[model samples]
Target: MNRTLYSGLWWLALPAVLGRLWWRGRKEPGYREHWGERLALGGPAEGQATIVLHAVSVGETRAAEPVVDALLKAYPDCRILLTHMTPTGRATGRQLFAHHGERVVQAYLPYDTGSMTRRFLRRHRPRAVILMETEVWPNLLHACARMDVPVVLANARLSERSLRRGQKAGAVMQEAARAFTLVAAQTELDAARIRSLGASNVEVTGSVKFDVTPPASALEKGDWLRSHIRAGGPERPVFLCASTREGEEVLILDAWQRLADKPAGSLLLLVPRHPQRFDEVADLVTARGMRLARRSQLDLDHAIDGADVLLGDSMGEMFAYYAACDCAYIGGSLLPLGGQNLIEACALGKPVLVGEHTFNFLDATIEAVGDGAALRVKDADALANEAARLLRDHAARMEMGARALAFARRHRGATLRTVELLQRVIR
Candidate 1:
């Protein structure tokens, strides 16, 4: 489709988009609270030399953290304008960079319609635009090009399925890809795939997630929580099913029940990917006859003492969860939902397990397995079995954890490399 058609279609979908925000706000009020920014109706930063960075949601936003800090240090005079589509992402941005005050600006990126995007660009007058990962939009790119705003797709990756979709779109995707000033890819394979999709200046800058360091405060908090739980009785292993989606929870619960050999007083940390599903997941946990303790309701003292499962229902605590767990099963892979990031777990020196489907993080998963930092299981049952076995074999788990830490440390220069690339455009 051409620009006009694409913009028209986006305009047509505005109601559906707003309706989605309203529906999602039933569970997360922040979705409904940011209507003006979502419509590009919010006033701009009101000055020149602003840099705009777009990260779609929590994962991308987290990955963009190091880069945001780097940009702030590299260009002190320029304000960093961070935009995100989800409430969680916005909240995360606020927590990570709010210390900078007005030097860092946070807002919802307007919907990818022609007029809205154009207005956003004209109003903000950004020196450069950087998009985290493979979030490409025809109208946004076209408007950026028309406004002479250099666009960079940083930490870019293109899955096989995504490449196929781009191929299907033919000219539209090709033209959109061409509009980018640079595509700083995570891997050579990602660079090749994006190049095949018509991105001209593609470079393998590696994955910035490797550069993320778990906060010392989170580590201390997790250690305290773990010690308190152990103080209640003998030590019990904590197995985290991190970032699980809707369909996969049932499978996990089934596996949890089938694992009759699980140690007494062991805790299962079930953290759903979406906030909206917390209540639904809690209900599912109770329906399965398992006692649930929500993190939101729990204090550091005795809250998790006798709970069969701990629902990580709070936000901005993923690293804490990773540090608290003995073993973790990366979620979103149990079904065909690709996979969530295992980098945090690895960085925390936690042994990791994954299910069969991991197309979203294919290269990273395979590399971790090759590095002996992670293992791939066939299904939910295998995931449960492996987690239990790892918990039992303390020596083996320690070895794997050591390898995980080593693997993470070896890939720590991506953020620096990505900043070097962005400097060219920012200059």
Candidate 2:
């Protein structure tokens, strides 16, 4: 498909897209709150936007933190215009950049129609557009090209599956790929795959996630939370299963229940990836006859007693969860969904466990496992067994945790390289 056809299709699907947003809003009200911004109808008043960065969802929003901080520091006079596709991404951006005040403005990225994108670009009048990760919209790229606005794909990655899908998209995806002024890829493999789709000026700048430092406030919160988890009883090992997707929770819960050799009095911390599913996950835990306590309802000062499972129902506290746990199992990899980021857990010096289907983070997972920072299990049963073994062997856990921290520290400096690449296009 060509650009005109792409734009026409988007216009035709506009109503359905809006309807889907409304449907999703029944569970997550944030979707209903930002209706106008998605259409380029209303948002922050016109200002000199130095850069417009699009981070699609929570993971991308969090990954963009280091790069955002670097950009702000490198260009003191610059004001950033952050954009997102999901309400959670918008909320995460708001929480992460609340300290910047007016320096960082945010909005929902307008629909990828030629007119809407053009309106968005004209309204912001940013020096350049920087799309985080794998966001390459055909109409958006065409609009940027027509307007002579340079676009950069920062901290980019493309897995083999995604590359195959993009190739199937054919002309539209190729044209979009070619329109990028530069691409700061997370790995050489990513750079090569992006180049295969016709992107030029691709540079391997690594992942900006390595540059993100856990906030002191979050660490302190973790310590306090750990204390509470251990309060009123003997010290218990906490196993965190974070960023779990739809089907993974059931498997993880079943595996936990079937574990015959698990350490005594160990607590399971289950955090679903989507907020709308928190209650659903809680129900899953209760259905299994396990006691569940929600993080939202718990008092910070009180001890969490007799709860076999703690449901992490809060948002923007992933780092705190990482810091509080003895071992972490990064979710979304058990059945075929591309895995979630395990780097946060590693950066906190926690031993990590991941499933075999981590194609999305294949490079990072392989390197972490090779460096002894992470262990990859083939199935949920193995994940449970290995986590149990780690909990029982304190020395093995400590040794692995040390390697995890070292692996994290060795992979820094992506933010600086990405900022330097942005500098080239901003001028």
Listed in order, each prediction's TM-score against the native is 0.97, 0.98
Shift of residue 59 alpha carbon in model 1, Å: 0.1
| Alpha carbon lDDT of each predicted model | 0.89, 0.92
Number of residue pairs clashing in candidate 1, backbone atoms closer than 3 angstroms, sequence gap of 3 or more or interchain: 0
Summarize candidate 2's per-residue lDDT along 148-240 as a digit string, tens digits: 999999999999999999999889999999999999999999999999999988999999989889999999989978888888988889999
Q: What is the per-residue lDDT of model 1 for residues 1-427, given as tens digits with 9 covering 90 to 100?
A: 7767777888898999899899989889999887998889985556758999999899999999899989989998999899999999999988888789988888999988878898899888899999999899878899989988889999998899989988988787888999999899999999999999888998898999999887888899788667766765788799999999999999999898999898677889999989889999999999999988888876743657788898999888889889889999999998989998889999999999998889999999999999999999999898999999998889999999999999999999998999998888876
Alpha-carbon RMSD, each predicted model = 1.3, 1.1
Error of 1 at 253 (Å): 1.4
Model 2 steric clash pairs: none
Highest lDDT scorer: 2
In candidate 1, stretches whose alpha carbon ends up further than 4 angstroms from where it belongs are: none
